[model samples]
Target chain A: MRINLASIHVDDQEKALRFYTDVLGFLPKNDVPMGEHRWLTVVSPEEPDGVELVLEPDDHPAVRPYTEALVADGIPFTSFAVADVHAEFDRLKGLGVTFTQEPTVMGPVTTAVLDDTCGNLIQIAAMEAPAS
Target chain B: MGDVFKALADPTRRAILDELQERNGQTLFELCTRLISKHGLSSSRQAVSQHLDVLEAAGLVHTRREGRYKFHDLDTSPLRTITDRWQLPTD
Candidate 1:
């Protein structure tokens, strides 16, 4: 099964959409009417038509506590694969993205961690060659 | 229609992941055998296959097609997305 997208609830839809699309280069995949809240989503250009990131509205009662607890506990909600951690890290840094961790070698893979400003610690990594 | 949380929201998927954490890598049959009995699940092979499909689509798991056996393992890339999206401070 191929995952098409990951979803995150946001306090401000427009602001979050801008950060994801304008700042991170994800293209809008879905933006349609959904009662009071619009069904919005985005996808990475690099993985053309790959996973879609669903931008959910944080109107639910659990959102505030969920987002706050995750941040307070320093728990990363998800991760992604990258061809090159250093390059991606540098490129994002150039864009003024604040990183909480630098690239570092870990056992079989080299990885770097960054803050998405949206309340998550995204990791970029270069996976080791497939086990022979 | 993917719920975005379609694959992850299930406790079964989470359990499958917890199992993967220990095994790291396993074929579909292996995972089923190992987990089926333990979880007391009464699903057919097709049902497990469907679940695996969801997991694969979510990018939470990776599968490599080998001759007759498809090897599966956890893919942590989307985990970064979850982490970043959650903005968890790792100090």
Candidate 2:
């Protein structure tokens, strides 16, 4: 099954916006006001033109604790795929991004873990070879 | 919480599954060292085994015994159920 988009609630919408758009290179897809907070989203530059990442505010009871726990532990809410994880890591590094983990080979894939610099650890990975 | 979503929710678990997706069978220690080490936190072999148990219970992953080690792999069949829940707008 395919996931169209993955979303996580943020404590500060504006910070989340800048991090996702400016730092990660995702394009802002929508910003709609929905009560106390707005429904903001960003889509990947490369896509089959599928799901956008929804930057939601962590105010709802169902979402607040989950987001908080992930942040406290530096665990990313989700990860996105890349064609070349090593190149992506280097490119982001040149842009002044700090990575928590460099790209390393793991079985049949090469993966890298990085700090989103926004209270999350985002992973970038590329498929290496077909499974045996 | 529902098992499948719970299995998919955590980034570490997701990474482990992603690794397995590319290489269908992997030892818990290999997954732990590759996926969890970057976070500066390492899950023990027992903990990884437990996570595998949780995934197996959720029907999100499958395990096979190879020699003395158990290899874990992604089982995307349950994801079809998750996909069915989301209805895309044709209009």
- Predicted model with the maximum lDDT: 2
The local distance difference test score of each candidate is: 0.69, 0.70
TM-scores for all predictions: 0.52, 0.54
lDDT of 2 by residue, A1-132 (tens): 888767776768889899888988888888999988888988888862769888877667767566545433334557788888988998899988765446778556787766665445577878885656
User: What is the per-residue lDDT of model 1 for residues A1-132, given as tens digits with 9 covering 90 to 100?
Assistant: 776768887777778788788877788889998888889998878876788888888888988788665543233456678877888888899999865445655456766655566655555778766767
lDDT of 1: 0.69
What is the C-alpha lDDT profile of model 2 across B1-91, one tens digit per residue?
Answer: 2478888787667767776776665545446766654444467756766777778888877777643235577888888777689966778
True contacts kept of 1: 0.00
